[model samples]
Target chain A: MNKLCQSIRFVAPFLLAICCIACSNDKKLPFYGQREARITKAADGTEKVDTVYQTIPPFRLLNQDSIYITQDAFKNKIYVADFFFTSCSTICPTMHRNLKTIFDAYKNNPDVMFLSHTIDFKYDKPSVLKKYGQKLGVDGPKWQFVYGTKEEIYHIAEHDYLVAVQEDQSAKDGYIHQGWLVLVDKHKRMRGAYDGTKSDQVAQLQKDIAILLKEEN
Target chain B: MRKIVLFLVMSTVIVTLIYSCQDAEQLEYQTYYSNGQTLYQTYCQNCHGEKGEGLGLLTPPLTDSLFLKNNRTVLACIIKNGATTPVTVHGKTYEEKMPAFPKLADIDIAQIIVYVTNSFGNKMGMYPYADINKDLKSCATR
Candidate 1:
């Protein structure tokens, strides 16, 4: 019995070290943005406990195939979202390329989808988006390029997704949008925001998506 | 001993010759095509692919396209001033307007054209700066 205890003591440090490393690498992804609380008074004047997590508000838009997509389209789905325009000559290309990497990684995943909102809706109609998706070799419904009223698009981008977007006549493309790729879980909660143009951040986003998937499973 | 020394000298010369040839090829590509590649990646690769396989029905492929071959001069113009009109490529019509790069200089346009023409299995020869200047002048006037 004494020998067994001594052996355990010697091996315990090594096991603990391995566990520490694993735990550090596999840390859980945090839920991003604010959380709201609602209080209700019962008939006896006792307060009811209720906490409401902030979620993406419902939205309706048209996809590349002229399909009407709404918030229900991503019901119980994990998705990555971004804002871009077809005419952008600078960061949009790099952002798309990086997003393509994630898209390819998660192509076979049924629970995963991509939502790209075009800031330039006037030019990026359903047909144009369809053609654009084809050019990039994107097919199927797993990834969707959506368009809607400029006001709603910008509103969702800034308020819902928590990304910056605006119109600037002085800019080269006559508009400006962020390179942020937001990760939304099945509950429509924003889980992570990555710089769509950076490979490392995108890789982290992919890792977080895997974590989220494991969590769902 | 003398024969061994001579053999070593000859081998060194042969090796140096091979290395020099490879270096020369790399230098030529670096001088002519690298700038155009950077410009293409920045401005064109989003629609036209890295290898010029243009995006689906939106942007036309730059590789072995009869349109690019027939409209070489007009390509420079299109780059300078974005094209809104419909262009037919590979028997399909693409109507997406390619935005213009009014910021690119004549020399920059010339380099990009040379890079594009010589890349993606294209054997078109170099587009001289002088020719680019002349074409851009005419385009500006019209």
Candidate 2:
């Protein structure tokens, strides 16, 4: 009886482990930011409660190619977005370095896209962003380096993307911002935010992107 | 008995001298290499990357032994006092401005030079930190 109990204890954990992995495989990414629930009546006269997720707002900004872009460009695609500038000497390099790995992995995929917004409005104009993108060896429309007025960028960063940004003269790089690589889904809702500096988190972002792509299907 | 004692004393002195001569230098190199790795991660790894591959053409890779060898004199200056001019490495020209590390002391620069030159497939030997004083002079004159 004791032998049977010992074997059961050993086998039970393996069973539980397999069960957890199975459950995790079917897990879905959660919607972030403020969500509202509403009651609606269907055409068949049935009342149903619906979830209205907060999404990215519409705005016009100049891309690295010096062309103005809008939400129409990302109508059918999901994108990963971050804020940085050409001359930032801090976490931006590491962040972009990690993001570039993801960019390369999904370079040919139509569903995946990457966007970077410059918080240093005074220095990183469209032309400067163009040079920076070329130097980083990332160009083309798959990955976009965008520029905009300080007010437009900062307001969207704080409210829509849930990332923080600020201009400070006392900071070492003349600006300060978070290093979140936010993942947005096809529905324009934020699904995840990963710290761009951490390789492990970026790896998770890669896996989550795959999972999100599958969920879309 | 006196002769045997003298022989033993002479052998001990010779062995101690040989060990100190060879082993001390090896120990010093090892110390510098390891310490420089820590310093590299803290200061240089961000732009140059973990493998010294560098980011596109934005920053020049440290893996080019020829460039490192030819530019050895100005390396110390470049580290302590940033560089604005374009530098060509591995047949590519990088014009981005490298930020300065004014806070790194002479010894720190030495250890970093030792680490960078030794690692990333380049086996250039120890560049003692004190040697940076001369590099600084050449740098200032230029």
Model number with the top DockQ: 2
Worst 10-residue stretch by lDDT in candidate 1 chain A? Answer: A131-140
What C-alpha lDDT, on a 0 to 100 scale, does residue B125 get in candidate 1?
67
Question: Model 2, B31-128: lDDT tens per residue?
Answer: 99999999999999988988998988888999999999998878999999999999999999999999999999999999999999998999999898
Q: Please write out the lDDT profile of model 2 over residues A76-175, one tens digit for every residue.
A: 8999999998898888999999999999899889999999999999989999998888888887888888999999999989999999999999987899
DockQ, candidate no. 2? 0.75
Model 2 stretches astray by more than 4 angstroms: A1-25, B1-13
**TM-score top scorer:** 2
Pairs with steric clashes in candidate 2: none
- Residue-level lDDT of model 1, residues A155-211, one tens digit each, is 999889998998899998888878999999999988899998777999999899999
lDDT of 1 at A115: 91
lDDT of each: 0.84, 0.93
- Classified by CAPRI criteria, candidate 1 counts as acceptable
> Once model 2 is optimally superposed onto the true structure by TM-score, how far is the C-alpha of residue A32 displaced, in angstroms?
1.6
